[model samples]
Structures are given as structure tokens and as C-alpha cells.
Target: MILARVEGSVVATKKNAKMTGNKFLLVRPLVIDSPTAKEWKPGTSTLVVTDSLGAGEGEIVLIVQGSSARLAADDKDSPVDAVVIGIVDTVDVGKHILFKAQ
Candidate 1:
């Protein structure tokens, strides 16, 4: 699993049958400054992930990639390389609280 933030969304009018009903979100991976640091840095890259949990933009989310992403969705055969599995509420790094959803 990877830690990411929902940056935006995507719309594909023409897609595969298995992915017809799914919503896609643009996400940017979050990188922790260090094991003892209480800050997160945005990644340089972004990706589109299937939103399985209805995550909204600007919300921190958990993303599953590769084969695990397909398994997270209802249709295992869907062409999904990444999926938003969970909406993060808080992030505690060691003894420091890095993030807490407001």
C-alpha cells in the first residue's frame, strides 16, 4: 500500500465494460520526511486510481497498486493498476503525529 492524496479526478467517457461504473481520481504520493519527522512531502509524479471508497479531492488516501489494486475493486478483471482503498484519518510517525484529518 502507498500513502497518497487525492489531487483531482478523471473522466473517461469511453472505457472498458468492466470499468464503466467506477470513478477515477488523480492522486499524488506522499513521502514522509523521515522516520522521526512529522512532515509529508508531495511526490513529483501523479497517477490515476480507481476510487473504491469515494475519496474526495484534497483528502489523504491509501492506494493499492499493481495486482493488489485489481483485487481491491469489485470487478477483479477491471483494468486498474491503482485503487484508492482507504481515506486516511491520521498519520502517526513514530512518536510524532504527522497528520490528523480535520
Candidate 2:
């Protein structure tokens, strides 16, 4: 799994039959400065992910890819490469609190 922030949403008028009702979101991966970092920073690249948990823009989320993503989706057969599995509330790294949702 990876930590990411929802940057925005994606609307597709036409898509694969299996992905008819899925909601897509643009997410930027979050990276820590170090193992004991006090904050999270957004990575340079972005990814389009399928969301089922109603995650909103600016919210930190947990993402799963590949086969795990397929399993996370309501339809296991949905053509998904990534999926938002959880909305993050906090992230504690060792003795440091890296993130806390507001």
C-alpha cells in the first residue's frame, strides 16, 4: 500500500464496460522526508485511481495497486490498476507524528 492525497477527480464519459460506475480521482503520492519526518510531502507524479470510499480532494488516502486493487474493488473483475482503500486519519512514524487529519 501507498499513502497518497486526492488532488482532484476524473470524469470519463466513455470507458470499459466493467468500469461503468466507478469514480476516478487524481492522486499524488505522499513521501516522508525521512523515517522520522514530521510531515508528509507530495511526490512529483500523479495517478488516476478508482475511489469507492467517497474520498474528497485534499484528503489523505491509502492506495493499493495491481491484484490487491482488483480485490479492493466491489467488482473483482473491474479493470482497475489502483484503488483507494482507506481514508487516512493520522500517520505515526516511530516517535514522530508525521500526519494528523484536521
Candidate 3:
């Protein structure tokens, strides 16, 4: 599981058969205020994450384990390794509002 933003969509003319009908999203890692980790790969490369979280452009989301993701997407045979599970509109860390979805 990681924190990433949807950079854009992906189109595969030829792909795995199980991947058909599944929306493939290109993601860039996000950088939050972290004392330990200072930088993030915002656009270095893109990951193909399943859109189980219903995340739109620029919306921050929560990604989870592939097993859990398989359940979320209702695709037991999906070979996806990464899955976006939640569309986070707001995040509260004690007295801080970390993010607002859109």
C-alpha cells in the first residue's frame, strides 16, 4: 500500500485477458509533510493501479493490499498488484487536517 496520485489514464491495445474492462490508471507518488521521508516521485514513472477507489483526477486515495483489493473490486481472478481502496476527502491527524479530497 502506498500514497499516490492519478497522473492520468492508460490505454492498452494488447493486454492480459483478465485486465479487460478494468480501468488502468497511471499514478505518481505523492509527497506529504514527513520528517523522515522528505521527497516523493511525483512524476518519475507511472504505476498501473486498479480504480477500485473511484478516484478521479487529482483526488487523493488510499491504496491497499492486492488481496483486499481483489475483494473491493469484486474480481477474484484479477492479477492487479495495486488497488486504490478509498477516496479520501479529509484526513484528521489529531489537530491537523491533512487532506481534502476535492
Candidate 4:
């Protein structure tokens, strides 16, 4: 699983039958924070993640990658990589607040 933020959505008319009803989101994978980091950059690749947590654009979400994404939907045959498994309500790291959702 990875921490990512929903950037947009994808609409595909020609997709697997099981994927028809699922919401697909474009996300940017967040870089793991380092205590002594001077620079941090998010991944350039945009991932298509199935939205199970009802996430929206600009919403910070928890994404489950690999075959586990299919398992989360209970469709082992579904072809999916990244999936929005949880909507991040708030991120509290000591005295830092990274992301928050209302």
C-alpha cells in the first residue's frame, strides 16, 4: 500500500465487465518521508486506482497496489493495480499535519 493523492478520474467505455462499475482515479504516489530529507518528489507516473473509499479529486487517499487491489474488491479475476482502499481523514505526524479530509 502507498499514500497517494487523487488527481483526476478515468472514463473507459471499453473495459473489463467487472471494471465497468468501479470508479477509476488518477493518482500521484507520495514519497515516503525522510527525517533528514532535503528534497522530496512524488512519482511522475499517474496510476489508475479503483475507488472503493469514495475518494474525489485532490483528496489524499490510501492506495493498495498489486494483485491485492483485486482482492479488495472481492474480484480475484479483476485486472487492477492501484486501488483507493481508504480515504485519509487526517494525517498526524507528531506536530505535523500532512493531509486532512472533511
Q: Between prediction 1 and prediction 4, which has the larger lDDT?
A: 1
In model 3, the runs with Cα more than 4 Å from the true position are 36-45
Provide the overall lDDT of each model, using Cα atoms, as 2-decimal numbers.
0.89, 0.92, 0.71, 0.79
Q: What overall lDDT, based on C-alpha atoms, would model 1 receive against the true structure?
A: 0.89
Tens digit per residue, CA lDDT, model 1, 13-89: 99988888889999999997765587889999999998868899999999999889878886677788998889999
- Mind giving the per-residue lDDT tens digits that candidate 4 earns over 1-102? 888878899888899887888888899987745674433357777888888677889888888877888788788888887778888888766666665677
Expressed as tens digits, the lDDT of each residue in 9-69 for candidate 2 is 9999999989988899999999886655777688999999999899999999999999999
TM-score of each: 0.93, 0.92, 0.73, 0.83
In order of listing, the candidates' clash counts read 0, 0, 1, 0
Whichever of 1 and 4 has more TM-score, that candidate is 1
- TM-score, predicted candidate 2 vs. hidden true structure: 0.92
Q: In candidate 2, what residue range of length 10 has the lowest lDDT sum?
A: 32-41
Q: Return the lDDT, model 3, position 90.
A: 73
Candidate achieving the largest lDDT = 2
Clashes of 2: 0
lDDT of 3: 0.71
